[model samples]
Target: MNTADFIKARAAALGFDVCRFASASEPWSAGERLAHFVEAGRHGDMGWMETTLERRAHPTSMWAEAKTAVVLGLNYGPGHDPLPEMGDASAGYISVYARGDDYHEVIKGRLKTLAGQIAARTGEDVKVFVDTAPLMEKPLAQRAGVGWQGKHTNLLSRTRGNWLFLGVILTAAELEPDAPESEHCGACTACLDVCPTQAFPAPFQLDARRCLSYLTIEFAGPWPVEFRKATGSRIYGCDDCLAICPWNKFAVASHESRVQAREGLVSPRLADLAALDDAAFRALFSKSPVKRIGRDRFVRNVLYAIGNSGDADLIEAARALLDDPAPVVRGGAVWALSRLMDDEAFAALRSERAGGEADASVRVEWAADQA
Candidate 1:
């Protein structure tokens, strides 16, 4: 077999579901779409996306010696449906991707191993990226024939569904490039219709400012008022659109153990998560990706979900968190109390807001509850 075939076989052996190569060059069309998305302020507080335009659009610009860009996909689809537990109000929902080990470390290690194997065989310089670099991975994956970019703007494969994590390897060695996959969305709007926040303004476009994933994980302030009600109990990331996709029927459980859901993360109790102190939270999520958001932000997200739970039993948990040191957490607690408790409880919390020195945003949240 030639070099391309050899690489493909090696990738499969290394547990990659699919592998494809693309010429290292500017992704002009994808860049144009990204530029439009950024210019519209659709990326929200993710300002890094705007600053790294050149590096994000062109692989050759990132590394001068790069000649072939190999894109690989690893399937992490769950065996059971993830939507049922989401309907349970007392249960806090975490995005499936984050329930286990961090994919960045897992995928990057495998990519490096693959790169080392290539170096030994061909003596070529290489770099591997697993979402850490500014590379437009979804576009590269599509160009490499792994999948088409779905209407929701995530990479989607017919065989693996939307449950694949992407990794890229850039090398100086020339490899035969694969043809890009054709778009399969057709006239179907299942993803758009199912979005709780209406994050997608149009087909193949996303406004991350309104995206629950961005609001819960990326945005680092008080949750935006407009999207809060739509956020439901999603504490980390939103998967409504992805879950509703018709293409998911073909998906199977991933063989990678690192991608499996943890015991507590699959559908955690809201009250239990709301009570987690910093150390306890750290101990529970030490190696998980959700820990990156930190205890304060994670607690704030839990408070929002508790507010939506409508379970009067959880109100005591929300009340106990009113004195949290982080104003963000305190503000979320106040909001939860306002939503889930009686007027007497809200009035009591409102009285304490005067003595508490909180951020201007949290103060506004307090006043809004009183009003």
Candidate 2:
């Protein structure tokens, strides 16, 4: 086999589900969409999107000598439907991918290994990037024939379906690029219709500010009152759109042991999660992706779900957090308590704690709940 074929074979041997190549200079039309997403302020608090647009718009702008891009996808399909967990209000629904090890580390290590093997064989310059960089991975993955960016704006394949962790390798060596796949999403809007928060404003366009994943994971402070009910039990990233994709019929559960769901992570009890102290949180999610959000924010998310749980049993869990030092956590607790108790009861509690509620943001949360 030639160098490109050899690299693909090595990638396969390394257990990557899909591997393909694309010219680094491929006319990435999605750049225009990204520009628009940022310009429209749809990215919300994600200021990084604005800062990186220039480089993300063009691969050549990122690495002038990049002659080829090797895109690889790691399948993280769930063992069962992720939707049911959303209805199980007593439990928190973590995005399937984050139930195990952090993909950034797992996938990046594999990417480096693949790049090293290629470097040894071809002796050409190479650089690898996971999601953190200002890289437009989905469009590049489509350009490489690994998958098409489904209406969910995530890479999905006929074989791999909607579950994929995309990583890219940029190389100076010129390689034969794969033919781009045409969109097969024909007459389907299941992904768009499934959004609980109506994140997708239009076909193939997502407003990140309205995305449950962004709200739960990225947007800090008190959970937005308007979206709290819609966020449901999703404490981390969401999978509503991806799980609803009809294309998922062809997908199989992920086999990567490192990426497989870790014990006690799937649909964990909201009460237990709400009780996690910082040390317990760290221990529970030591190498897991959930730890990235930190103890306060993760608890903040759990409190939102607790508020909506209506279990009433978790009311004490939410009540205890109302005095927590973290303003965001206190704010989230206020929202949870408001949901669990009536306005009269919440007002009484607010009156008692009014003096200690020193944080302005938490005060805002209190005022909103009272309103």
Candidate 3:
């Protein structure tokens, strides 16, 4: 077999569901869309996107000698739908992508091994990336025939639905490129309709400022009041769009043990989550993708869900966090109080904020709730 055929076989053996190659040239069309997304401030506080503009547009700019870009996809589809659990106010919803071990560590380790094997055989230089680098993985994956970018702007494969994790290997050797997949979304707008925050301003576009994923994970300060209600009980990330995709019927459960859903993570109790102190939070999420948000942000997300839950049983939990060190958490506590507390209880919490060292942002939330 030729080198390309041999590499393809090796990729399948390595557990990659799909693999394809493309030139490390500028994905100019994607770059233009990215430029517009940035210009419109759609990326919100993700300042890193603004800094790495040039490198994200062209893979060659990231590694000048990169002649071939091999894109690989790992399927992480769960055995059951993850959406129904979102409505259970007692349970917190973590994005499916984060339910397992962190993909960066899991996928990169496999990619590095594959790259080493390729290098040993072909004697070519190789570098691998798995969401940690400035590479435009979704665009490259589409160009490499793994899938087309869905209306939600995530890579979607016909065989894997939208349940794939992308990784890239940049090499100095040129390999035969795969034909890019044609867009299959057609007139379907299921993803856009299901957005809790209406994050997509237009088809295939996202305004991160309003996205629950960004509000819960990427954005550092207090979440905007307008989106707090829509965030629901999703403490880690949102999966409304991905879960609603009609193509998901074709998705099969992933075999990667590391990506399988842990029992506690699949549907953690919100009351238990709200009571988590820093140490408890660390212990529970250690080595998981949810750990990246840190204890405070995660707690903030939980608080928003608690407020929307309207479950009076959770009132005590929200009260416990009234003195949280992080303004973001305290603000969410205030919002939760507003939603779950009676007029008297809210008045009591409002009085406490008057003499407290709460940030102006939190005070705004406190005042709004009181009003």
For each candidate, what is the lDDT?
A: 0.86, 0.87, 0.86
User: Per-residue CA lDDT of candidate 3, range 211-285, in tens?
Assistant: 888888998877766787788778888999998998998899999999998879977888899988899998998
RMSD of each: 1.5, 1.3, 1.5
Clash pairs for candidate 2 = none
Model 1 — TM-score against the truth?
Answer: 0.97
What's each prediction's clash count? 0, 0, 0
> What TM-score against the true fold does each predicted structure earn?
0.97, 0.97, 0.96
lDDT of 1 by residue, 222-281 (tens): 876667767778999988888888899889999999989989998899999999999999
lDDT of 2: 0.87
